[model samples]
Target: MPHLTSPAPTTAERIRSACARAGGALLAVEGDDPVAVPVHHLLSDGSFAVAVPLDRVSTASHGMAGSQALLELTDYAPLPVREPVRSLVWVRGVLHSIPPSELTETLDAIATENPNPALLQVETPRSTPTNDDETRYTLLRLDIASVVVTDSTGAEPVPAADLLAARPDPFCDVEATLLWHLTTAHNDIVARLVSRLPASLRRGQVHPLGLDRYGLRFRVEGNDGDHDVRLPFHKPVDDMIALRQAIRVLMGCPFLNGLRARR
Candidate 1:
């Protein structure tokens, strides 16, 4: 089935849209580079270039015939503008070349929005097998797909018509979904903190007092009497501090970093 790739939007606009849509966007590109890296390379003819690295050459050729590949560009870069690095606006679309005249606006937008724009130089693909020079390549004009915009400000509760137009969806459903996931994640912390309690202290008298500013509070009844205990979970979710310490531990889990704050 043919996938629909949306038009390009401003980076600021895309981040705002992405934030509004959610924290970040997931792009499906058949390539060898990281999703955030640019696949565009400048040519002498003033056109964008798409490079098919050696590893992905076969895949690119199989899918897109005649030295061209479809790409879904996303702005997943973490801009270190705030304490917690702010997420950038990401756009996704089928990157295909149009007549130079038609791409005037799109070209201008890419130049302004890209944070660290790099070029991809596609080498020509050779059919003949050679022992000396095994590698071959092909370069094509760069193009983009949908632009998912978002930011810290997000969409106001009462948004203006123009402001609403800038968003990918009708409203800020992405942020709403993220908040929902975060809220439900509180239960996970409650379970973990309860498990951490000593079995002797957890026996007969441990009664949960519910969560508060201090964290999970419980009254433990021992042979003597009842004693109040609080488990302050500063980083129940993705603790940046602990994350650094246990980066290796979380390397396998892609969603671990985002869910840490909820824990």
Candidate 2:
């Protein structure tokens, strides 16, 4: 992929998009004996709401509000690649337990945004009720303090304000579906697109890696190793029609062959 020398402002938006698709995150509590747990999460308005089984709730925190914690979210390529991890976002925040009174409202909001079968378990009754807290569930909220995004561009801290204000790319959610279609259903198109790469890279097996409003990313498998490259659109696209048009233009470019030789 094109090396981004400095972290872009879009980093925050990309992090948010990743969180939406991740389904869950790795929560790490800071202390002498740190605890880490995988918990289902929802990110909204710069805060992360996580659903933890009653058993792991105390491990996540000391049952204290305003505790310090870190939430790590990763973005991976939809397809197989040498380096599947595209990026990582670490969120530093203060953790707080949600009151039982608000659990219903909190879970409803999470379901409305990203529905998952696991959330349904919360509504089901447990047959055996032991005083063991593990029989129940708890919702924990992490109030944002800072967000650090690490990718090919390198790691940098994004201001809480900037992270809250940013919005994910218009095509963030559907890019994976579209890329999957292009790779599985459209080999001829992919070949034509790969013909645009530099002559040295054309010998490699190319596959779609990712897509964003700015461009398309591909993974090239060669004898030495796998490499990533970005093919930028002539202009950024916002809607499906425009994205299609831009792709068509890229594939139809007669000068791509010539450009390959020059590269």
- Could you give candidate 1's per-residue lDDT for residues 71-185 as a string of tens digits? 3333321211112223343333344434445344444444464322231122322234545444333333543323333333353221223333443322233333432342365
| Model 2: per-residue Cα lDDT over 176-256, one tens digit each | 788889888997878877776667765677888888777777788888877777777767778987787767667775453
TM-score of each: 0.28, 0.77
Clashes of 2: 1
Model 2 residue 235 CA deviation in Å: 2.3
Of candidate 2, the 10-residue stretch with the lowest lDDT total is 1-10
Regions of model 1 farther than 4 Å from truth? 1-27, 30-38, 41-52, 65-84, 97-121, 124-145, 155-263
